[model samples]
Target: MNKDNLAARRAALIEQCAEQRVGLAFELNALRPSKVMAGLPLAGYVAANRKLALGAAGAALGLVLMRRKRLAGVATSALSAWKMARGALGILAQLRR
Candidate 1:
């Protein structure tokens, strides 16, 4: 068999062994018994909700990060100017005046 087929067979064998050891029946009927949802299929609904939520969240995060970066830059420039003013004042005071 090809490499892909061989890998798949190995995976199946491992899963079968694990299932047998765990006393699980080897059938699709072994699906989670408590997860049976009796309702109309809402695959489209789920997909739309996921798309919208992801888009909104990404936009919000991008805006917040951009604002944070802008504010940080402004703060750094202001602090630099303040330091320069203080240094100039100190130098002037040391002169004869």
Candidate 2:
């Protein structure tokens, strides 16, 4: 109601706002990685080994064309598993950075 009380209240409000700003900043910083990754595709992963992907594709095609059904199935499965593992490792490496 008085000048001193008003000033004190204003000071408290300012301090509270400052604290809130800092807390918000910290929270945003913590979420920065997730935010960055969200903007990226599939865990920020790309098949970097073009040669490997191409080779696998070629091998898969060959197997199919050769009419080796069982071998082609195994090769396809292995390639898929390798791709997944590579992606997971890449994500982990990026997070570590």
Candidate 3:
């Protein structure tokens, strides 16, 4: 191609690249940590009440440490119940088929 045609093609490519860069920057801005966290409901609540959330978390940790044995027994009972229910469901499904 001639010099003018090449120059015109180069200018078009440059404009296209600039447009892509701007679009990419906008997309990256949307994916930023602060923007992403702001969109989450829990994150917004925690951000609004940082002290309250921290206090609740600390209390939960303290309870878990103090009642570890009781928690373990409850967890074991729950697991047993879940397994029994799952087995019953499987048997019912097989009977239906």
Candidate closer to the true structure by lDDT (higher is better), 1 or 3: 3
Model 2 per-residue lDDT tens digits across residues 2-76: 999999999999999999999999899877766666656645443345577678789878776775777878779
Badly placed stretches (over 4 Å) of model 3 are 39-59, 68-97
Candidate 3 structure quality by residue, lDDT tens digits, 3-72: 9999999999999999999999999999886787886989978877899999999978876786778888
lDDT of 1 by residue, 1-97 (tens): 7999999999999999998867755344456432233232454454447888788789778667777778788779979999999999999999947
Candidate 2 local accuracy as lDDT?
0.81
Q: How far is 2's C-alpha from truth in model 2 (Å)?
A: 0.6
> Which candidate has the highest lDDT of all?
3
Rank ordering of all candidates by TM-score, starting from the highest: 3, 2, 1
Predicted structure 1, TM vs. truth: 0.31
Q: What is the C-alpha lDDT of each candidate?
A: 0.73, 0.81, 0.91
Q: Please identify which of the two predictions, 2 or 3, would achieve the higher TM-score against the true structure.
A: 3
Superposed Cα RMSD, model 1: 18.4
Cα TM-score per model? 0.31, 0.38, 0.47
lDDT of 3: 0.91
> How well does model 1 score by local distance difference test?
0.73
Q: Each candidate: RMSD to true structure? A: 18.4, 14.5, 11.1
Q: Local error of candidate 1 at 65, Å?
A: 12
